[model samples]
Structures are given as C-alpha cells and as structure tokens.
Target: MMERPVRKHVRLKHYDYNQNGGYFITICTRGRIPLFREGDRLSAAGMIARACAEEISNHFPEIVVDLYCIMPDHVHFLFMAVGTPYMASVRSNPTISKVVQQYKAAVSRRIGRPVWQRSFYDHIIRNPTDLEETRRYIAQNPLKRMNSNG
Candidate 1:
C-alpha cells in the first residue's frame, strides 16, 4: 500500500492554546464530502456531530459554544475559553486542541467511523471586532453555500 504524505502542522508554535480567548474553528469532512444534509434537515451523522459540539459545555466548563454553523461538508464554530482564576479548575482544563479532539472523537464514535479530516482550521479572535466578523462569516456560510450552488 502507498503511504500517505505527512501533513504540515498549521497551528501556531509557541502559542498557549489553553489561555483565555475566543477561537474560530472550521472542521471539514474527510475528502470534503457533503454528509451532513438530508433534504432540508440534518442527517443522522450531522445530528451526532451537532450533539457532540453541544456536549463540549458539559465536558469543559470553561469553554462556551457560540455562533456555529454546520455546512454540508464542514462545520464552523466559535469557542470562548473563560480562563479566569475563579473559573480555573482541574476538571475544566482543556486546550483548543483537546476540545476539538473530544468533539471529533465523540462524533466518530457515534457514527461508527471517522468522518473528519486529519486536522482542523482555526483563527484566534484578537478583539471584539474580530469576533463579530468571524461570527458574521460563520452565520452567513449557509447562504454563501446556497448561492454558490445556485
């Protein structure tokens, strides 16, 4: 069998992902296949993925889910890590990587197979303006997709 080519690491080096901040993340399906829709509603796999995303709050108290959109082939979501001294705890210790891993793992398990690409894409939201821009981008993804298809 032919070996797969190694993928380059896209995450920023020397960055502390566990630090308090907001992150915009995009996770695509393996091979960029559209597997999340059945007519106008979400498929079983899509529903499972959505559940896993929502379940992040239960697993990590410091992470808040905001402004997420699940497209036919990918998902875009914002995560806010509330890393205050009062909120810091062993149980809630999770970096952005850990959060994505747990979410992908949960969805894979529920679907009985892996459906995600090897790694996800993320952008650190630097300020309120950045956050709002990313939020708007994510919210409008479906319309963009619709327009593109038409």
Candidate 2:
C-alpha cells in the first residue's frame, strides 16, 4: 500500500488567533483557476468575492479589513483584530479561522459554487515594518500579476 504525503501544518501552535493583532491572509481559488480576473478588470465572481470580503467587517465587528486585492486566482488582505483578550473571551470573539471560513462561504453562496481551496495562508504581523510591507504587497498584487502575464 502506498502512503500519502504528510500535509505541513501552516499555523502557529499554542498561539491565540483571536488575540488583538494584525494578520495578512491569502485565500486562493481551487485549482488555481483565474475565476476572479478578466484582463485588467475583475469578473462578476471577483466582484462578489470582493464584496463578501468587505462585508466581513460588518459581520465581525472586532475585525477591520485594512487592505485587499482580488487577483486572478487569489485574494490577499490585511485585517486587524482590535478586540482585547478579555473582551474576546467575554464576547466569544471569532477567530481568524472562523472569519476566513465565513468569508469563503459567503463568496461561494453568492457565486453559486465553491471557489476556495481547503485552507488559507496567514502571517501574523509582528511589527510596523511587516504591516507596511504587507499593505504594499496587497496593493501591488494585481499589478504584479498583470506584469507577469504580459
């Protein structure tokens, strides 16, 4: 019998994801299909995805979507968890995982199909430099993609 390859764990263990901090997240479309972009513009599905992502803040009051960019096959964003640890516990604040799950479901429902991969990639922003760099990266992602494709 052949053995399956082990999937690497992407999250930091023993860390509280609901804690107040900044996070950089990337969610890619299943199969890397270009479902979100049409030339230099976003497709209907992309627009839906972008809208759903923006609505995340409305649903999770403690989260603020700082910056985002919908790329051809992926979306990148930075969000800040502004709730304090005591408040998080008192209100049962949504974890980053939960937030991403809800965003994916919203996009899927609006587009009438599942568009995301199983899990998302996240980086906990540790400092001012990292935060600024991530913001720049998200803002420039579409341009980078366009340049690479041309």
Candidate 3:
C-alpha cells in the first residue's frame, strides 16, 4: 500500500473564517498554466471561472465580491463578508475557502478537466490600508505581465 503524503496547513489557526471581514485570495491554475489569455481574448475555461467568481454573491448572500483580476495563470480577488442575522443562525455559513472551492469546481466541471491547484493563497484584510494595497496589486497584475511580455 502506498502512503499518502500529508499536506501543509495553509489556514490561520484559531481564526474564525465565518467572521465578517475582508479576504484577498489567489487561485492558481494547475501547475500555474497560462490558461487565461491576455487583453480581451480570454479562454473558454477562463470565462467559466469568471462567471463562477461573479455568481458567488448570488449563492452566498453574506459574501460580496469586490475587486477581481483574472490573469493568465492565476486569478486574484477581494471579497468581504457582511454577516447578517440569517448568516449567524446558519451553522454552516459559507466561508472564503468554501466559496473558492465552489468556484474552482464550477470551472472544472464546465471545462471537463481539473483547473486548480490543491489550495489557494489568502490574506485577511486587517485595515483599509491593507485592502487598498491588495486592490492595487490585483489591478496592476495584468499591466505588469503586459509590460514584461513586450
């Protein structure tokens, strides 16, 4: 029998993921493939991912998808959760990790292939300064790539 390798824990310990706060997340394609094209030429798989990202708010009312950028190999976005009375009552309110997993699953189903890495990268927004900085980073990602390519 083959032993399964243990994966490293990426989430913060003792942190309540359901708590109302802003989260910046990055979901990379499997092996960091450049699936999304540059400029207006987004790939079909990328379109599915974009749609899934936009629809997260509809599926989970507490979540609000803020700024987002779909790069060639990865996608970055900022989402904030505004917990309401309804959210508090629900024992399994959707967390950022769950939302990202759903997004990846949706894209994978549409494309008929696994399109995501094992886990995503996330940063909890601590303040307005942190939020602004993350937003700027996401927005400039495409431009940075374009400059490098040229």
TM-scores of the candidates are 0.90, 0.93, 0.89
Best by TM-score: 2
Question: Cα lDDT of all candidates, in order?
Answer: 0.87, 0.90, 0.86
Candidate 1 displacement at residue 49 in angstroms? 1.1
Tens digits of lDDT, candidate 3, 1-150: 999999999999888887788999999988999897656578887788788888989988888988889898899989988865244456555778888888888889988989889999989999999999998998888888889878
Instruction: List pairs with backbone clashes in candidate 1.
Output: none
Question: What is candidate 1's local distance difference test score?
Answer: 0.87
Clash counts per candidate, in order, are: 0, 0, 0
Q: Give lDDT tens digits, candidate 2, residues 1-150.
A: 999989888999988998899999999999999999898888999999989987998999999999988988999989899965755348755799999999999999999999889899999999999999999998887788778878
Residue 39 lDDT (model 2)? 86
- Model 2 segments more than 4 A misplaced: 87-89
Best by lDDT: 2
Give RMSD to native, each candidate.
2.4, 1.6, 2.3
Better of 1 and 2 by TM-score: 2
Model 1, 1-150: lDDT tens digits are: 999998898899988888888999999999999898876578988898888888888988889998788888889989999855334354444889999998988988999998999889999999999999998999888888788878
